[model samples]
Target: MKGTISHRDSFLAHIQQQLGKSSSKPASIRRPVWKHRVNWETNEGLSKEELVEQLKVQCQQIHTRVVETTPKEAPSTLRLLMKEYGEGPVMTSSDRRFAQYECHPMFQALQKEGISVTSWNADTSREENIRQAEQAKYAVVFSDYTLAESGTVVLSSHQGQGRALHFLPMMYIVCIEKSTIVPRMIHAASALHRLVEEGEQTKGAIHFISGPSNSADIEMNLVVGVHGPVRAVYVLIDDE
Candidate 1:
C-alpha cells in the first residue's frame, strides 16, 4: 500500500527545491556590529572570605553610576509601580509544582502580613483553592528568571497550576533569583533550549511580564489591565 504525502513534508520539500544550491550567495550583507562583554563578576570562584570581598567590589562597581537608595525606597517604588495600573495589595499561593521557589523569604514575609496566603498543594481542597483566587486582591508569583534589559519576569505553569494566577491578580510580586538575570533575549532562549535538550518538559505557558498591564486603545488614554497583571513587582532575591 502507498502512503499519503503529508502537507508539512510537501511544503518543506517545495521550499528546499526552491532554495537548493544557494548556500554560497550572500544576501545584501550588512556590516557586523561590535560589542564588548562586561566581566561583571569580581573574582573567579573566590574563597568564602574572598567571595565577600569580591561581592563588595562588585557592589561598588554597580553603585558607581546608580543612585544611593534604601531598601524601604525599593519596596515603595515597587508598590508605586503596581499602583500605576490601579492595583492594590497582593494575595499569594505556594504551588507545589514549584517547590524550589515556595520557600522564598518574600513569600514568608508576605504571609506574615496576613495577605491571604494559600497553597495549591495536595493538602488543599479544590473549592478552597478557587475561593482563594477569586477573593485575591492580587496574585504575586515567583519567577524562575528575569531579563534585566527589558525588566521582564518569567513564570512557568505546571500541573495543578492554573494559568489564572498570573492573570486574575490585580498586582503581581514576582521574586526573581538574581543568578538567572541575563542581558538579552538570545541568552534566555538559550537557557530554555538547554533545558529542553536535557529532556525536561517545558510547560505550555511561559510568561515574560514587563511592567503593569496596559493598553492605549481608546484615544490612547493608557488604560491598564486589558489582558493580564495590572501591576508587576520584580523582587530580586539574593540567591547567594
Candidate 2:
C-alpha cells in the first residue's frame, strides 16, 4: 500500500513539473500579414497567358526574352534555338529536370548534329567544370521559382549547381518549372522561411536574377554581360 502511494505521488509531481515547465516557456508569437496583393490574384494560380503577360513586362525591363512552350515541345524548341546559335559549346548543370532529355531522341539528334554539349558531373572537379562553362556560349540552369510581379527568378545553388554557373556563360537559359511560379517576391520569401522551418537542406547561394548583366558605370555605354550573361532566355515549362 505504501509503495503504491509513493509511486502515485511521484507521478503526480512529475506531471506538475511538466505543466510548470510548459507554462514557463514563452508562447508562440503570431505575425500579422503586411501586404499581399500584386498585379494578379495572390491566392489563385496564374494561367500561361497571365504568366506570359506578366513575364514579358518584367523581362523587357531587363533585356531578357521569354520563351513560352509546353513540356512536350520544350526539348525540341531548345534544340532549334541552339541550332540558331550555330557551332558553340553548351554547358548545363546536372539538375534532375534536364536529365530526362539525356535519353530522349530530340537531345540525341542534337549530339548527332555535332552540338558540343557538356554537363557538370559528380566525378569531375567543379572549378575545372566552371572554367569550361566560362568558355561556352550558353549555360542552361534550372530556375527554382519566378516572381511574377518583379520579373525576377530565384535560383538557389547547391553542390550540383554552383554560383559560377550563374555568371560565367555569355548566354543563360533559365528553365523554370511552371508550378513553382509565385505572384511576388514575398511569396518566394515565405517559401524560403517555410523551408528553413521544416529543416530542409537549403542552398548555399540564392540568386534572384532579374535580367541579363547590365552596367551604366562606364560612360553610360550600357554594356551587357560586363558582369554576367549578356543575354538571358527564360524557358517556361508549362506541362513539365
Candidate 3:
C-alpha cells in the first residue's frame, strides 16, 4: 500500500502521548462567532430601486455598462446593444427567459438579417457547443440573480447553459430582470439554500461574474479580458 502507514494506531497514540492528551479520541472544537455582522447588514434598508442604483454605481467601478429598459422595449434595447457591440455572430444560452421576455424573436430576426446567432443546444455534444462559443463575437445570457453590493451576476449552469458560454465569448451581455436584484450575496445564498430545503436540486455550477475578466501583472499594468470577455454589459429589464 503506497499510502497506508504501518501501525497507524500506534503512530497516532505516540503523537497523542506527545501532546499530553490522556484520551485517544480527538477533542471536539467549538466554532467561533464573530462580533460583526456587517455583510448581512450592509444593504439592509435599501428598496428595490435603491438596490438597482447601487448595482449601477458598482458597475461603473468594475468597468461594466448598465442599461435600463422596460420589458416591452427589451428586444429593441438588445438590438441596439448588439449593433453597438458589432452585430453577431452571437452565442446565447438556451435560457427560457429569452422566449418569456419575448427576445427570442429578435434573435431569429437578426439571423434573417444575416447576423449569425447561435443558441446553446442541449442535444449537441460539448465540443460542438465550445466550437460555437469560440467563434462568437458576443454571448448573451439571462442572469439568475444580480448582487447589488458587488455588481455581480449569478449564473447557475445546467444542461442548457454551460461554463464555457460565459468565458469564451469576446463580449458578454447579461440580461437582468429588475426583480432579481438583491442586496448582497447573502440573500442569493439564502435563496439557493431554500431551494435545497424545498427538495429542489440546484445546478452543479454557479458562477459569480463581477465584470469582464481583468488582471494585473508584477509590473502592475492592468489588463482586461485576460481570461474572459473583453467587454461586459448588463441590460436591466423592468419586468416587475
Candidate 4:
C-alpha cells in the first residue's frame, strides 16, 4: 500500500513539473487576425463594368510608366515590348507551316531563338523552380487568380512554383485569365482561406505582386530591382 501511494505521488509530481514547465514557456507566435470584406461588395457604389474600366485605365497608366521609365538606353517601345513578351516564329501544327504571331504563341519562338523555356509541371519541385527563376531572364506563369484593382497576381507558392519564382527574376510575366480577376484583396484572401480549410495543405507564404520592384530610397533617386523584379508584365486574356 505504501509503495502504491509513493508511485502515485511521483506520477502526480511529474505531471505538475510538466505543467509548470509549460506555464513558464513563452506563448507561440500567431498569425495576425484580420477582418476581411469582399472588395467589390464593399465598393457597392461602383458597378462591375465601371470597376473593370477603372482597373484597365489604372493598369494602362502603370504599364506606360514602366515602359517610359526604362532608360531610353533600351530600344524602341514596340521592339522592347515584343522582346519582353516573347520571341518565336508562330507555327500551327494543323496548318503544317510557320507563321508570324506575337504573345503567348510566341513563347515557342522564344525557345527557337535559343532562350530557355521551362514548363512548370503540377508536381515540380520547389527548389528547382527557384534555381531556374534565378537564372532565367523571364518566366511566363499561368496564375490561379488576379486582383484587378491592385494589379496583383495570386500564386499558391506550392509544388513546382515557389514564391521566389514571383520575385527573384529580373522580369516576371504572368498570364491572368480574365475571369479570375477579382476587384480586391479580400476576395483573394477568402479564396485562399477556403482552399486551406479544404485541406489543401498549402505552404505558409502568399505573395501579392502589384508591379515592378523599385525604390526611391537611394538619394531619392528611383532604382529598379531594389528588392524584387525590375519589371512585371501581366497579360490579361479573355475568360473564353
TM-score of each: 0.56, 0.77, 0.85, 0.61
User: Against the true structure, whose lDDT is highest?
Assistant: 3
Model 3: residues with Cα > 4 Å off, grouped in runs = 1-36
State, as a TM-score between 0 and 1, how close model 2 is to the true structure. Answer: 0.77
Clashes by residue pair, model 4: 87-109, 87-110, 88-109
The residue-by-residue lDDT of candidate 2 on 126-221, one tens digit each, is: 778888788888888878788876779898877777788888888888887787787787778788989988999877878898888888998888
In order, candidate lDDTs are 0.55, 0.77, 0.91, 0.57
The residue-by-residue lDDT of candidate 3 on 199-229, one tens digit each, is 9887888999999999997489889999889
Residue-pair clashes per candidate, as listed? 0, 0, 0, 3
TM-score for candidate 3: 0.85
Candidate 2: residue 227 lDDT (0-100): 89
Among all windows of 10 consecutive residues in model 3, the one with the lowest summed lDDT is 23-32
Per-residue lDDT for 1-240 in model 4, tens only?
A: 454445876677688797875434347677765576344466545555565565566666454122221222122332355475555221111111111113334455456777666654445565665676677666546567766565667776655556676676666666555567677788888888998889988766777776778778879987767897676766554443
Give the TM-score (vs. native) of candidate 1: 0.56
Model 2 / residue 118 / CA error / Å = 1.6
Query: Alpha-carbon error at 209 in model 3, in Å?
Result: 0.3
Top-down TM-score ranking: 3, 2, 4, 1
Give me the candidate number with maximum TM-score: 3
